[model samples]
Target: MVSSDHIGPNETGRIRATVKTDGKKGRILKTVQVETNDPVRPLVVLKLRANVIDAFHEKPLQPDAIFRSPCRKCHLDRGRDQMGAALFRADCIMCHMRGKSAPSISSLKKLSRERLKEAIEEGVPDSMMPGFSWRVGGPLTEAQIRSLLKYIKGR
Candidate 1:
């Protein structure tokens, strides 16, 4: 796919590249990246049309990809539900827990809801437990913090 900026359709001063993957038949379908220059009004159109860094080029994620967050391994990926799931899988709690692993969603099932929320606030320091960045810290949003809690609890 291509992103057209103020470069006015097919123009010059742009960058272009092609990506392809091997197919079972030995042939492959390639993804293309063609950028036209229009410094006058370029305005970051690379991502507006296609993210050049994406290897799959809009292809459905592989199973492993589904297990992690696409945006940031350190931050939320999609909706709260998906983001939380990614956090849980990534063992985000261990960021400060040191040698301990993040509580499994199954194990969290045994904890009381009140306790869970409390733990979220007071992270298991030395482990990967990242206190809800939005709660008492800076940066992370409320939704992300909430998602981390929800993900920890396997909700």
Candidate 2:
């Protein structure tokens, strides 16, 4: 849904927003999409249930889709444009801090799942690494973090 302003014909970025349906019972869902302009990004026409009732339906385009969420850094971007890559990129702190000797997680060059998980839980001290398990203001939820790990593992 990244619209014309944030996403031109060729800007690589991310889309994250929520969709919800209101009724006797409703649910809110968060969605994320990453894309490079190689092929015009496909419009995602998500058909969703508007309420807890299976019969209810609602389809809302993500705000980030309407307004592209530009990634802060593009130099480090490899093919990790996917959400899995974004999760792995979280480890860039430790990878680049160690410099040549440290593994380059920023490159999206796959890493052992366990290693990446460890990096998330117990960051490399004295380096840019920071533990998400108890970060005072970091955004990832435990479930979200696990989902990202599982997704990367599958990849």
What lDDT tens digits, residue by residue, belong to model 1 across residues 66-92? 224442433333233545666455534
Candidate 2 global TM-score: 0.31
RMSD of each: 13.7, 18.9
Error of 1 at 33 (Å): 30
- List candidate 2 stretches off by more than 4 Å: 1-102, 106-112, 135-137
* Cα error, candidate 1, residue 9 (Å): 46
Question: What digit string (tens of lDDT, one per residue) describes model 2 on residues 111-130?
Answer: 77778777656555655445
C-alpha TM-scores of all predictions: 0.34, 0.31
lDDT of each: 0.47, 0.46
* Whole-model lDDT, model 1: 0.47
